[model samples]
Target chain A: MAEVTFDKVRKAFGSAVAVRELDLAIRSGEFVSLLGPSGCGKTTTLRMLAGLETPTSGAISIDGTVVNELAPAKRDIAMVFQSYALYPHMSVAQNIAYPLKKRGVSRADRDVRVAAVAATLQLGALLDRKPRQLSGGQQQRVALGRALVRDPRVFLLDEPLSNLDAKLRAHMRAELIELHRRIGKTMVYVTHDQLEAMTMSDRIAVMHDGVLQQFGTPKEVYETPANLFVASFIGSPGMNLVKGELRAAGSGLAFVRGDLSLPVANGGTAGAAVTLGVRPEDITLGAGPFACTIRVVEPTGHETIVMAEAAGETLVARAAPDSQLVPGQVVPFAVRAQRLHAFDADGRRLPLVFAQSNGA
Target chain B: MRNRSLTSRILLNVLAWSIVFVIAFPLVWMILTSVKPQFELFRIPPTILPQEVTFEHYHRVLVETPFLKYFRNSVILAVGTTVLVIVIATLGAHSLVRFSYPGRERLAQLVLFTYLLPSVVLIIPLYLLMVWLGIANTLFSLMLAYTTFALPFALWLLRSFMQGIPQDLEAAALVDGASRMEAFVDVILPQAVPGIISTALFTFILAWNEYLYALVLVNTDEARPLTTGVMNMLITAFNIEWSLLMAASVMMSLPVIIVFALLQKHLTRGFGAGGVKG
Candidate 1:
C-alpha cells in the first residue's frame, strides 16, 4: 500500500477545464471518497490518478515517487469500473487472471491466486461462467474479483455500485466497507451518492463545477460545512436556508423576510445580509416560536419529509414518520438554536459560536 | 370467438402459402427446365416435373465452354477481393471510430461520399487507366476495381459495428495491461463478429455476381467469372443452348443463396434493431 499525492493538478480539454487546480493527499491504508454530481470532475480526478487520463499540468506521486509518466499497470493500481467491464467472451477465472498473466506470473501461480480470490468472493462455482451468464450482482462480484487478484498498491472504484439495483447497492456498499477493512489498502472511491460517501469513507472530498469545495471526514463536512454547496449537497432533506437581512432582535438577533421573521439565538455583526440553515431534524414541529404552512408530506418509513413555505421561501423538514402530519396543514416549528448554521451573503459558513454543538 | 378465429386463421395460412408458391414459381420452373429432357421441355403445356431428369446439360456446360476455368477464376477473384476489402475497411473504420485525429470527422464524411459515388461515372476513366498500366484484361485489374468500389460500403458497415462496442471496454482493457491495438483486437473485435460476418457476405455476393467490370476487363474465358461465362453461352447458330444456360444459372445462384441463408439472423438484427448506434 502507498500514499497518493496530487500537487496542483489542472486538466483541461481544449478550453473547458475538467479539473481546476487541485491538490489532495491520501495517506496509506486510508479510504478517501471523491463525491460530486456529474460534470463536477470527480471522475476526471479519479481517472487522472489512475493514469487513464493525463492532467494538463500537475505532479502526481504514489509511494513517494512522482508517477505522472507511469501507466496504470506500471503504477500497480487496480480499477473497478461502474459498468463492471468484464470481458464478455472470457470466463470469470480468465478475467481475474488477466493482470497476473500480463505480469508473467506462472500459470500455476496465477490459477492458485485466482482460485483464492474467487473463494474470498464466494465465486468458486462462478469461475467457469461467462459475464453474460451471470446476473447483475454476480457480475459485480466478478468485477471486484478481477481487481482483487492483483493486490495492487491502490484500488480505484468509479461508482462501482451505481449499476446495481437499490437493495443490491446498499448490500454491496457494506460489503465494500468490510473488504476494505480486511485488505486495508489505500482505496479511492468516486461517487455522487452522498449516502455512500457518508457510510464508507474515512475522508470525503466534495467537488462542484470542477472545484474542490471541501475535504473532511463525513461528520466534519456534515456539521461544519465550509460553504453553501457542501452544506446542501451532503444531506438528504438538505439544510433549510432562510434568506433575510440580519438585525438585532431581543437579546440576540433575527432574520426578517416578507411577513416572516425568524429569531436567531446568537447575534452577529449589526445589520448585514445572511442566510440561516437548519437541518430538517433540527426543526421542531409544534407550536413553539415559528409557524409555516405544510405544502407536502413525504413518508419514507423511518422519517417523513415535510415541505413547508416559511418566510416566503420553500424549506424541507425531516420529522418522525409516525408524526400525524398532512399536506395543506400549517404548523409551528422552532429551530434548535444550537443547531442553526449561519452563512454570509457569499455563502461562506459563519464561524460557529455554539462550539459545543452535538455535530462536532 | 376462439372457434371462429381458429378456422379463419387456417384459411389465411393456406392463402399465404399459395401466395408464396406463386411468387416462387419462376425460380422453381427455371431449376426444373435446366434438368428436364429436351423431349419433355416446352411440351404443349409445359411439364410440372420432368418425366426424365438428365445431367446432360451439366456435363456439356462443364466440358465444352471453359466453364471450369471460369469458375476457378471467379472464386479466386471474389475471395481475394472480399478478404482484402474487409481487412482494409476494418482497420480504416476502427481508426475513424476510436481516435481523435485532426479533420477526423471530415475524413469520415469523405469516405462515405466515396462509398456512395457512382461506379458508372468512374468506369471510363478507370478502364483507360487500366489499359495504360497494361493490365486491361487481367483478373488483377478486375479484383482491384471491385474492391475499390466495395471498400467504402464495407468500411461504413464495420464502423457501425465498431461504434457499438462500448468505449469503456477499450479503456478497461488498456487499464488492465493492453496496448491500444491489443485492446481493439482482444476486446472490440470479438463483439463485432456478427456485423463483420454480415458485411463480408454482402461484399462477397456483390463481387461474385458482378458483370459490368468482368465484361469490360476480361476478353478471355481464362479470366471471366460465372456471370459473363453464362452470358457467353448465347450464340445465333447454337440457339443460346437454353438448357445449359439454365444449368449454369442455377450454379451461379447457389453461393449467394447459401451465404444469405447462413447470415440471415445477423442481417435481420443488423438492419432491424441492433445497428451501430443502437
Candidate 2:
C-alpha cells in the first residue's frame, strides 16, 4: 500500500481544462472517493493517479516518489473500468492470470494465484467460462480478480458499480467495503453517486467544474458542507437553499426575503445578501415560525419527502412516511437554527453561531 | 392449413435450389468437361455427360506440360503475399485504431483510396518499378506487386475489425501491468483472429488469380505462375487443347476451394463480428 498525492495538478486538453489546481493527499490504506457529476474531472484525476493520463502541470507522487513520467505498467497501480472490460477471448481463469503472465510468472505460481483470487470472488465454478458467457456481476468479479491478482500498491476504480442493477449495486457496494477492509489497500474510487461516496469512503473529495469543493469525512461534508455547491449537491433531495438578506433582529440577525423572515444566529453584516440552507430532514413539519403551502409529496417507503412553497421559494422537507400532507395545504414548519447553514453572495460558507433549536 | 404450409415450404426449397444450381452450374460443367473424351466436344449438340470418362487430359497436363512448375510458383506467390500483407496490415490497423498521431485519420482514408484504385491502372508503373529494381522475373517481385493492392485492402478491413474491440480491454490490460505491445499481443490479437483469417484468405485469392502483372513482368517459364503458364499452353499448342485447359483450371481451383472449406467458419464469423459489436 502507498500514500498518493496530487500536488497542484492541472490537466488541459487543447485549452479546455479538465482538472485545475487540484491538490489531494490520500493516506496509505485509506479508501477515498473523488465525487462529482459528469465532466467534473473526477475520472481524469483518477486516471492521472493511475498514470493513464499526464497532468499538464504539477506533480503526482506515490509514496514520496514522483510518477509523472512513469508508464502505467511501471506505476504498480491497478484499475477497474466502469465497463468491467473483461477480455472476451480469455476464460475467467486466464483473465485473472493475464497480469502474472505478462510479468513472466511461472505457470504453477499463476495457477495457484488465480485459484486464490477466483475463490475469493466465488468464481471457481466459472473459471473455464469466457467473459461473454458470464453474467454482468460475474464479469465485474473477474475484472476485480484481475486487478487483485497483481497486489498493486493502489486500486483505482472508475464508477465500477454504475452498470449493475440497484440491488446488485448495493450488494457489491457492501462487498467492496468488506474487500477494502480485508486488503487494507489505498483505493481511490471515482463516482458521481454521492451515496456510494458517503457509504464507503473514509474521506470524500467533492468536486465541481474542475474545482475541489470539499474534502472531509462523510458526516463532516454532510453536516458542514464547505460551500453552497457541496451543501446543495451532497444530499438526496439536496439541501433547500433560499436567497435572502441578513438584517438586525434584537441581538442576532434575521434572514429576510419578502414575507419570509427567520432569526439566524450568524456573524454576517446586516443587509448583506446570503443564502440559507437547511437539510430536508432538519425541517420539521406542522409547527414553527414559517408558514408554507404544500406543492408535492413523494413518499419513498422509508420516509416522505415534502415539497412546499414558502415566500415564492420551494423548500423540500422530509416527514413521516404516513404523513397526511397534500398540495395547497398551508403548514407551519421550523428550520433547525443550529443545524442551518448560511452562504454569502459568492456561495462561500459563512460562520453560523449555534443557538437554541428554533423548533416549536 | 398443414397441407398448404407443406406446399409453400416445398416451393421455397425449389426456388432456393434453383438459385444454387444456377450459381454452381459452371463449376459442375468444368469438372465434367475435364473428364470427357476430347472428341465429345464437337458432337453435333454437345453432350452434357461424356459417353466414356477419360483421365487422359489430367495425365497429360500433370506429366506432359510445365503445369507442376507453375503450380509451385503460384503457391509460393499467394502464400508469401498473404503472410507479408497480414503481418504489415495487422500492425498498421492496430496503430490506426488505437493511436492518435497527426494525420492518422487521413492516412486511413488514403489506405482505402488506394484499395479503391483499379489494379489495371497500376500495372504499367509497377512493371517499370520492378524492372528498375532488377527483380522483374522472380516470385519475390510478384509478391511485392501483390502487396501493393493486398496491403491496403487488408489494412482497411482489419482496421474496422480492430475498432470493434472495446478500448477498455486494452486499458484494463495496461493497468493490469501489461505494456502496450504486450496488451496488443494478449488482448487485441486474439480478439482479431477471425478477422485476420478472413483477410488472409482474401489476400491469397487476390494473389492467386492475378494475371496481368505476371504476364507483363515475367517472361521466363522459370517464374511463370499458373495463370500465365496455362495461357501459354493454349497459345503455344498446335491444336486448341480445351480438355487439357479445363483439367488445369480444375487443378488450379482446388487449393482455393480447400482453403475456403477449412476457414469457412471463421470467414462467416468475421463478416458478422467485424461489422458489428466485438
Candidate 3:
C-alpha cells in the first residue's frame, strides 16, 4: 500500500479544462471518494491518477516517488471500470488469472490462486462460465476478482456500482467497504452520488466545476462546510438560505428579511447584508418569529418536508411525521438560535456574537 | 395465442416451399443436365426428367481434356486469395476503427467506396502492371488479381463488426499489464470470430465467381481458372461434347455451394450482430 499525492495536477482536453489545478493527499490504506455532479471532473481526476489520462501540468506521486510519465501497466495499479469490462470470450477462471499469467506466475499456482479468489467472491461454480452466461451482478464480482488477484499497490474504482440495481448497489457498497477493510489497501473511488461518498469514504472530497470545494471527514463536511457549494451539495434536503440585512434588534441582533424578521442567536453588524442559513430540520413548524405559507408537503416516512414561502424566498421546513398540515396553510417556525449560520455577500461564513452589537 | 385454420397454414407452407424451390432450381438443373444423354440435353422442349442417365460425361471430363489442371489452379488461387484478404483486411480494419490518426476519415471513406463498388475498372491498369512485373498468365498473377478485388469488401465488412465491440475491454487489458497491441490480440480479436469467418467466406466466394479478370488476364489453359476453363470447352471441333462441358460446369460450382452451406451460420451471425448495434 502506498499514499497517493497529487501536486497541482491539471488535465485539459484540447482547450476545455476537464480538471483544473487539483491537490489532494490520500493517506495510505484510506478510502477516498471524489464526489461531484456529472461533467464536474471527478472521473477525470481518477483517470489521471490511474494513468489512463495524462495530466497537462504538475505531477502525481506514489509513496514519494514521481510517476508522472509511468504507463498504467508499469504503475502497478488495478482499476475496476464502471462497465465491468470482463473479457467476453474467456471463462471466469481465465479472466481472473490474466494478470497473474502476465506477471509470469506458475501454471499450477495460477489455477489455485484463481480458485481461491473465486471462492472469496462466491464465484466457485462460475469459473468455467463465459461472461455472457453470468448476470450483471455476477459479472461485476468477476471483474472485482480480477483486480484483487493482481494484488497491486493501489485499487482505483470508477463508479463501479452504477451498473447494478438499487438494492445491489447498496449491497455492493457494504461489501466493498468490508473488502477494503480486510485487504487494507489504499483505494481511490469516484462517484457522483453523495451518499456513496458519505457511506464508504474515510475522507470525502467534494468538487464543483473542476475545482476542489472541500476535503474532510464526513462529519466535518456535514456540520461545518467550507462554503455555500459544499453545504448545499452534501445534504439531501439541502441547507436553506434566507437573504437579509443584518441589524441590531434586541440584546444581540436580528435578520430583517423583508416583512418577516427573525432573531439571530449570535448575529453581529448592523450594515452588512448577510444570508441566514439553517438546515430544514433545525426549523420547527409550530410557532416562531416569522410566518411562512406552506406550498407543498412531502412525507418521507420519518420526516415531512414542508415547502414554504416567506419574504419572497422559497423555503423548506422539516417536521415530525405526526404534524398534521396541508398545502396553502399559514405556519410559524422557530430556529434553535445557536444553530444559525451567517454568511456575507461573497458567500463566506462569518462568526458573529450575541451581545456584541446593539441597535443600528 | 394461435388456433390457425388448416387450409391457411397449408397455404403458407406451400408458399414457403415454392420460394425455397425457386432459390434452389439452378443447382438442380446443372446437376441433372450434366448426367443427361446428348439427345435429351438439347431437346426442342427442355425435359425436367430424362428417361436415361449415364456417368459417361463425368468420365470424359475427368480423364480427357485439361479439366483437372484447371481445378488445381483454381483451388490454389481461391484459397490463397481468401487467406490474404482475411489477414490484411482484418489488420487494416482494426487499425482504422480502434486507433486515432490523421486522415482516418479519408481512409475509411476510401474503403467504403471500394466495397460498395468493387472496381472492375482497375483491370486494364493492373494487367499492364502484371505484365511489366513479368508475371502475366501465371497462377501468381491470378492470385494477386483475386486478392485485390476481395480485400476491400472484407475490410469494410469487418470494420462494421469491429466497431460494435466495447472499447473498455481493451482499456481494461492495458491497465492489467498488457500493451495495446497485446490487448487487441488477446482480448478483442477472440470475440471477433464471427466477423473474421464472414470476411474469409466473402473473399473466397468473390474470387471463386470472378470471371472478367480471369478471362482477360489468363491466356494459356495451363494457368487457366475454372471460370475461363468452362468457356474454353465451348470452342472445339464439330464433334464437341456437350455433356462433358456441363459436367465440368457442375464441377466448377460444387466447392462454392459446399462452402456456402457450411459458413452460412457464421455469416448470418455476423450480420445479425451488427443489426443490434451501431
Candidate 4:
C-alpha cells in the first residue's frame, strides 16, 4: 500500500559505479519492473529498495517517509531472490510461517495463517516436506507463499522465474500476474527478461549502463522506444536498425541507402547520418516498392520471422506462418509509413511527421 | 565396461583394506598388549594374543593410581576448551563472512596466519601469561592455553565453511522481520551445524592429546590431562608397567573414537544445496 520513490539514487562499489543518478517513482499498488541486461544496475536498484544496499547518495522514501537509514527488517518489504533461498532446515509450513513467527505471532495463529497460505498456493499436502524434497515449481510457490504470508508493504522479486523450465515459467508468469491483481502490493521486479517485464509490469523501466533509458507502459516502451537501445531491446527479434541517411525526395523525405529507399515521416538534417528503426511486424512482405533477398525463414508454429537483406543490411520481419518464405528469394518489402522511427547519428529519436502512402 | 569396472572395484577394495589394516594394527596391538600378562608382553617377538588375560593392570589403574582423577581433569579441560573455542570461532567466522568493516579481510587472514605458527613457539608466552594471571598448575591454565592454541584453526575452518552458506538465507530472514542477530541464531547458526560439530571435534582432540602445555603448565595429577599423566607413568625409575601404560592409552583414546563415530554422519551430510538454484 506504499508508493516507493527513489530520488537521485546512486550506488557504487569502489568507484566502479553499479547504479547512478536513478530517479524513479513507483505508484502505490503498481507493478513496476527494472528490466535490463546483467550488470545494468537493475538488481542494485532493487537491493536499494529492499534495504539490502544503501544508496551511496540521495534519499529513498516509502509512502512519504524517508528510509535512508532504515534496516531491511524495519522496512516492511518482502523479496523473492533469484534463488528462492528457502530455509533448508525448515519444513514447507515452517518456511511459510517464518515471517509471521518473526513478527511474534503465536503458534496457533501461525499455523492457521500458514495453512491458509499453503492452501492458496495448493501446497497443503506438502506442509511437512523439506524444501529439497519439493519440485522446482513447488519450491517457487513456497517462496511466493513466504512473501505473500507477510503481506508486506512492497514485494520485490529478482528474476524469480529465470530458473524454471519454459512451460513452468509461462505458467508462473500468469500466476504472478493474478497474484499481483489479487494482492495489489507495490511490486518492483528486477529481471533481464523483457518479456517478463512487458507481460507483468504496469510500467517497465528499461535500463542500460546503470541509467534508466525509458520508463513507461509496455505498449509505450515497445511502440515508442526512447532511443536506439530501447528500440532494439524491447521487442522479440528486436527492432531492425539500419544506418543510412535521410534525403529530401519529391514532396516528402525518404530514407536512402544503396538499393532501397523507404518513405518515412521524417525530420532530420539533409544527408546527415541517421539510423532507421522499425518493428518486424510493421513491415509488409510480398508487395512493396523495394525488393529484398530472403536469407532465413523461421516459422515458429504461429508466426514467421523472415530475415531479408536489402541495401546490404538484413532486416527481420514477422509475417504469417504460411507465408512460405524461402532463402535466396527476392521479395517486395514496404514498411508502414507512420511506423518508422528515425534516430540521428547520436542515437536520439527524431520526431516523425506522417507522409503520404507511396506504396499499395 | 562392466568387466573392467568390476576389476577396478576389486583393486580398490584390496587397496582400501590393506591401508585400513596398516593403520589399525597399532591400536589392535595396544589393546592386545593391555590385556596381556607381563610375561607374555616381554616374550620373544611378543605374543600376538594374550596367553592369559589379567585384570591386574586395570585394577591398579583404577585403585592404585590417580587415573580416574586425571581422566576427569582431561574431560573438563577438553570439553571446556572445545565449548569455548566453538562459541568464539563461530561468532568470529560469522562476522568475518557477513560483515564488511575496516581491516576485516586483514583480520581474517590473521586467523589463518596465527594457526600457521608452531605451538612450541607460543608456549613460552602462553606459560608466562598463565603465571601472570596466577593460575599456573591449575586446570584453568591448561584449558585457557588449549583454547588459545585451537581457536585460530577452529576460526579458519569454520570461516571457510560459513562462507559457503549463501547470504540470501540471512537476507530472507531480515526481510521476514527478524533482526540480524535473530537471523543468525535462527537461520545461519542452524545451517552451520556441521561446521560447529567439526570445529568442536578438532579442538577437543587437540586439547585431549595435548602433552607439552599440559606437562609444562600442570605438575600435580589433580590438573593433568591423560597425555601428561600417562607420560608420567613412563618416567618412573622402576620397572615400566607396559600393560598399565597401554591400558591408560586405550582408555584415553576411547572417548575421542566414540565422539568421532557418533558425529561422523553429520560431517559428510550434504546440506550444501540450501535449496537455491545457483
Candidate 5:
C-alpha cells in the first residue's frame, strides 16, 4: 500500500481548466472518495492519479516518489473504470490473468493466482465465459478481478458502481467496503453519489468547480460542512437555505427576513446579510416558533419530505411518514437551534457557537 | 381480418422471393451453363435445364489451358495483398482512432479521399512506377498495385471499427501494468478481429477480381492472374467456348465463397458486438 498525494495539481485542456490547485493527501490503506458533480474534475483527478492523464501542472507522488512523467504501466496502480471495461474478447479467467501475463508470470503461477482471485470474487464458475456472456454484476467482478490480480500499491476506481442497478450498487458498495477492509490498500474512489462517499469513505474530499471545497470525515462533512456548497450538496433533499440578515434579538441574535424572525445561538455582525441553513430532519413540522404554509409533501416510506413557504422563502422539512400534512396548510415549525448553520453572503460558512442550553 | 393479413403476408413473401431470384439468377445460370454440354447451350431456343450434364468443359479448361497456374498466381496476389494491407491498415486505423497528433483527422479524411479516386486513373502511373522499380510483370508488382486502393479502403473501414471499442478498456489495461503497445496487442487487436477479417476478405476479392492492372502490367503466363488470364482465353481462341469460360468463372468464384463461409460467423458477430456497454 502507498500514500498518494496531489500537490497543487492543476489540469487544463487548452484554455479550460478541468482541475485547479488540487492539493490532497490520502493516507496509506485509507478509502477516500473524491465527490463532486459531473464536469467537476473528479474523474480527471482520478485519471491523473492513475497516470492515464498527465496533470497540466503540479506534482502527484505515490509513496514519496513523484510520478508525473511515469507511464501508467510503471506507476504500479490499478483502476476500475465506470464501464467496468472487461475485455470483451477474453474469457473471465484470461481477463483476470492478463496483467500477470504482462508481468511475465509463468503459466502455472498465473493459473494459481487467477484461481485464488476467482474464488475471492466468486467467479470460479464464470472462468470460461466471455464478458458479453456475463451479467453486469459479473462483468463488474471480472473488472475488479483483473485489477486485483496485480495487487498494485494503490487502487483507483472511477465511478465503478454507477453502471449497476440500484440494488446491485448498494450490494456492491457493501462488498467493496468489505474488500477494502480485507485488502487494506490505499483506494481512491471517485463518485458523484454523496451517499456512496458518506457510506464507504474513511474521509471524503468534496470538490466543486475544479476547487477542493472540503476534505474531512463523513460525519465531519455532514454535521460540519466547510462551506455553503458542502452544506447544500452533501445531504439528501439538501439543506434548506434561507436568505436573510442577522439582527439583534432579545439577548443573542435573530435571523430576520420580512415578517419571519428566529432566535439563533450564533453571534454575527448585527444587520449583516447571512443565509440560515437547516437540515430537513432537524426541522420539527408539527409545532415551533415559526409558521409556514406547506407547498408539497413527499412521502418516502419511513419519512415524509415537506416543502413549505415561510416569509417568501422555501424550506424543506422531514416529517413522519404517517403525518397528514397537506399542501397550502399553515403549520407551526421549529428548527433545532444547535443544528443550525450560518453562511455569509459570499457562500462561506461562518463559525457559530451553540451552547447546550440552545438545544431545542 | 386474419385472412387479409395472411394474404398480405403471402404477397410479401412472393415479392421477397422475386428479388432474391433476380439477384441470384446470374450465379445460378453460370453454374448451370458450366455443367451443360456445348450443344445444349444453343439448341433451338435454349433449354432451361441441361439434358446431358458433362464435365468436358471443366476437364478441358483444367488441362488444355493454364487455368491452374493462373489460379495459383491469383491466390498469391490476393493473400499477399491482404496480409500487407491489413497489417498497415490495422496499425494506421488504431493510430487514427486512439492517438492525437497534428493533422490526424485531416489525414484520416485524406486516406478515404485516396480510395475515392478511380483505379483506372491510377493504373498508368502505377504501371510506370512498377516498371521503373524492375518488378513489373511479376505477382509482387500486382500486390503493390492492389495495396494503393486496398490500403485506403481497409484503413477507413477499420478506423470506424476501432473507434467502436471503448477507450476505457485500453486505460484499464494500461493501469493493469500493460504498456501501450502490449495493451494494444492484448486488448485492441482481439477486439478488432472481426473487422480485420472483413477487411481482409474485401482486399482479397479486390485483388482477385482486378483485371485492368493485371492486363496492362503482366503478359507472362507465370505472373498472369485468373482475371486477365481468363479474359485472354476469350480473345486468343479461334472459337468462343461459352461453357469453358463459364467453367473457369465458376472455378474463380470458389475461393471467395469458401472464405466467406469460413468467416461468416465472425462477420455477423462483429455487428452484434459493435460496442461494449456496462
Candidate 6:
C-alpha cells in the first residue's frame, strides 16, 4: 500500500487549464474518489497519477518518492480504464497475466497467479475466452482481474462501472468495496456519478470546471458543503437554493424576495443579498406557514419528488409516497430551520447564527 | 414494409449479375485469350472459345523466355516495396497519431500533401538521385522508387486507422508495466492487423502494376518487373506473341488474387471493438 500526494499539480493544454492548483493527499489504503461532471479534469488528475499525463507544474509522490519524472511502467501502479481496455487479441488469462509477464515472471508462476485471480473474480471458466466473447459485466471483471493480479502500489479506476447497466453497476460497486476491504490497497477512483462516489469513497474530492470545490469525507461534504456548487451538487434531488435579500424585520432580519418572505436569523448588513438553501429531505410536507403550489409530483414507490414553485424559482422537495401530493395543488411546507444553509452573493456558504422568529 | 415482389427480385438479380459480368468480362476475355492459339486472337469476330485450347503459350512463358526470371524480379521488388512501405508508414503514422511535438500537424499534413503530388513530377529528381547513387537500372532503384510513391498513401490510411484505436488501450498497457514500445508492438500493432494487411496489399499492387518508374529506372531483364517485362516482350519478340503476352498479364495478377484470398479472413474478423463497447 502506498499514499499518493499531489503537490499543487497543474495541467494545461494551450491556454486551457484542465487542472490547476490540485493539492491532495491520499492516505495509504484509503479509497478516495475524484468526483465531478464531464470535463472537470478528474480524469486528467488520475492520468497524471498514472503517469500517462505529465503535470505542467508541481510534483506528485507515491510512498514519499516524487514520481513526476517516472514513466508509467516504472511507477508501480495499475489502472482500469473506463472502456475496460482488455487486450482484444489475448485470452482472459493472458490479459490478467500481462503485468506478470511484463515483469519477467516464469510461465508456470504466471499461469498459477492468473488462475488464482480468475478464481477470486469467478472467471475460471472464462480464462480462455476472448474479451469480445464476454458480457459487459464479465469484461469488466476481467479488467478488474487484470489490475488486481498485479498487486501494484496503487490502484486507479476511471469510471469502471459507468459502462455497465444500472443493476450491474450496483453489483460491481459492492464487489469493488469488498475487494478494497480485502486487499486494503490505496485506490483512487474517478467518476462523474456522485452516488458511486458517496457510497464507495472514504473521501470525495468534488470538482467543478477543473478546480477542486471541496475535499472531505462523504458525510462531511453532504452535511456541510464548502460552496454553493458543492451544496447543490452533493444531494440527490439537489439542495433548493432561493436567492433573496436579507432585510430588517420587526425583531430580526428576514429573507425577502418578490412575494415570498421568510424570517431568517442573520447578522449580515441589511439589504445584503443571500441565498437560502435546504435539502429536500429536510423539508416537511404539512401544517407550516410557508406554502407553494406543487408543479409536479413523481412517486417512485418509496418516496415522492414534489417540485414546487415559490417566488418564480423552482424548488424540489421530497415527501412520502403516501402523502397524496399532486400537481397544481398548494401545500404547506416547512424547512428544518437548523438544517438550512445560507450563502452569500459570491456563492460561498455563510456561517450565520439563526435568531428564532417566534413562529412569525 | 412488405418485401419486393418476385419479378422485382428477379429483375434486381439480373441487374446485379449484369454489373458483375460487365466488370469481370475483361479479365475473363484475357484468361480465354491466354489459352488460345496465336492466330485465333486476330480471327474475325475473335472466337469466344478457342477451337483448340493449347498450353503452348504457358509453356513458352515458363520455359522459352526470361519470363520466370522477370517474375522473380517483380516478386522481389513488390514484396520489398510493400515491406518497406508498411514498416515506415506504420511507425510514422503511429507517431503522428499518438504524439505531439514540434511540427506534428505540419508533418502529418505534409505526408498527405506528398501523396497528392503525381509520381511523374517526382520521377525526374528521383532518377537523378538514383544515378548519383550509382544504383540506376537496378531492382533496388525500382523498389526504392515504389516505396517513396506508396509511403504517403500508406501512411495516411494507417494514421486514420491508428487514430480510431482508443488511447486508453496503450495507457492501460503502460500502467500494466509494459513500456511504450512494448505496448505498441503487443497491443496496438495486433489491433491494426487488418489495416496493415490492406496497406501491404495496396503497396504490393501499386509496385507490381507500376510502369513508369520500372521503365525509367531499369533497362535489363535482370531488374525489369512484370509491367516493363510485358512491354519488353511486345517490343522484342518481333512475332508479336499475343497469347504469351496475355498469359504473362494473367500470371502477374494471380499473386494479388491469392494474397487477398489468404488475408481476407482477417479483413472480416470485425476487430472485436478492442474491448471498447462503442
Among these predicted structures, which one has the highest TM-score? 2
Please identify model 3 stretches exceeding 4 Å from their true place: A66-68, A245-255, A260-275, A326-329, A336-360, B1-23, B38-40, B43-47, B116-118, B132-135, B220-223, B233-241
The candidate 1 chain A region of ten consecutive residues with least summed lDDT is: A351-360
> Per-prediction fnat values?
0.49, 0.92, 0.79, 0.90, 0.95, 0.95
DockQ for each candidate?
A: 0.45, 0.73, 0.65, 0.81, 0.72, 0.80
Q: Distance from true position, residue A52, model 2, in Å?
A: 2.2
Error in Å for residue B16 of model 4: 6.5
Candidate 1 TM-score on chain B: 0.88
CAPRI-wise, candidate 4 is: high
Per-model lDDT: 0.85, 0.91, 0.85, 0.88, 0.90, 0.89
Cα lDDT tens digits for candidate 4, B106-141:
998887788788889988888899889999889999
Candidate 5 chain A has its poorest 10 consecutive residues by lDDT at: A351-360
As a TM-score, model 3 comes out at 0.89
Best lDDT goes to which candidate? 2
Model 6 lDDT per residue over B1-278, tens place: 13558778889999999999999999999999999898888899869988999988888888988888889998999999999999998899899989989899999899889888988999899999999999999999998898887998888778878887878899999999999899999999998887888788888889888999888888888898888888787657357777888888899889989987888776554233222333
Docking class of 5: medium
lDDT of 6 at A339: 81
Error of 1 at B60 (Å): 3.4
lDDT of 5 by residue, A145-228 (tens): 988988799998989999899999999999999999999999999999999999999999999999999999999999998889
Instruction: For model 5, state the Cα shift of residue A39 in Å.
Output: 1.7
Cα displacement (angstroms), candidate 5, residue B264, comes to 3.5
What is the lDDT for B235 in model 3?
53
**Candidate 3 or 6, higher lDDT?**
6
Candidate closer to the true structure by lDDT (higher is better), 2 or 6: 2
By the TM-score metric, which is better: model 2 or model 4? Answer: 2
**The best candidate in terms of DockQ:** 4
